[model samples]
Target: MLGPLQVRGKDGPLRVPPGRQEVILAALLLEANRVVGTNYLVDLIWEDNPPETARTQVQICVSRLRKLLAGADSTVSISTRPPGYVLHVDTGDVDSLLFTGLVAMARRQRDEGETEKAVALLKSAVALWQGDSLTGLVSGPLANKAHQLDEERLSAVELRMQLELELGRHDRLVGELQLLTHENPLRERLRGQLMCALYWSGRQAEALEAFRTGRRILDQELG
Candidate 1:
């Protein structure tokens, strides 16, 4: 039932259990930060021509999910609206949502010449992602959201590294950046960051080597 469902972690690979309840929660979270109407929820979960108990079923699912979230975090809320329900989860509480906020804030701070704050914020955001976005969730709108959030998070890291180089933190970032670039060989920006870090670390030849390798990988993979 929804009572045993977990968000992303805090139990055995947090996930909304498989069934109509999971379907309902997915629909709500898809539009997290906004309201979803009763009719629309019915349509999403049951598609065309729901049974006579459709309304009752939706109410039950929402109520159960609300209870599960309550057990996890009291602030995680699903509130009533005239037409339906609103999921009012803070963007900061979820890794993907928080990652987006941090990236945006870091960019603004960087633009304002607040490098230290920008680096700190960006690092915190990137650190929240232990692995791929939505580690346990299957493909869906939520999966797409997780992927986009991850891309934004990576961009934030690149931006922070640029500022770090400006602040001469290359020696500190070089090893980690090397591993990052190796893991994401297809990411030219990450490779570029590693190159720049090497260059700023006073390893001009190695920096050039990094650039060459990046270019070769790009040519081979992307042509």
Candidate 2:
């Protein structure tokens, strides 16, 4: 397993094998690095109503997932407590958590005016993203969590780029910021960064053009 939720070596994002086992694994990943109550897991899988054999089924799923993960650098484990079971996966092994930690560190470094170090940390954080979080996972609470994580990841990228620009690394960042602007046309902050980078790169006309484009986009998209 690439992670608790992300299975690797597949043609694409790992498909959660169709069944209750997949559901259980997905839930654990959504709550990755946290202690998820068994009660909560049951509720999530069965929507507050479980089969007479629900507890047994959950156990089966957990057991199977453990075996599935054994072949890889298995860090995921099932922890049993009085109230419920917790899937304990290390945060460093999970890309999203790693990204979050890196971004947080980068922000702290940036705030401390360690621009070069911040840039390095931020780049590593962004590089951890394989693609959209839980790309092939079934949509539900788990998907929402993935989306939220993705948002945080993107926000970190923007923050890092902003810091780089502030450090007069705009010339180095112009290409990346320009690409991000094209992909995230509705993100005003990204557009602003693109403008800043362009202006500092001695492309005053491009900076003005970017501002106009952003304004037009906001007007058209929001108005």
lDDT (CA) per prediction: 0.74, 0.75
Off by over 4 Å in 1: 1-30, 37-60, 70-73, 80-83, 90-97
Off by over 4 Å in 2: 1-4, 7-19, 46-56, 71-73
lDDT of residue 152 for candidate 2? 84
Residue 115's lDDT within candidate 2 is: 90
Pairs in steric clash, model 2: none
Q: For model 2, how does the per-residue alpha-carbon lDDT over 189-214 read when each residue is reduced to its tens digit? A: 99999998999889999999999999
TM-scores of all candidate predictions against the true structure:
0.75, 0.82
Q: In model 2, what is the error at residue 97, expressed in angstroms?
A: 2.3
Cα lDDT for residue 118, candidate 2: 92
Candidate 1 lDDT over 27-106, as tens digits, reads 66656778888887777666667899998888998998887777665566788887898888766555556666787888
Clashing pairs in 1: none
**The CA-based lDDT of model 1 is what?**
0.74
Which ten contiguous residues of candidate 1 have the minimum total lDDT?
1-10
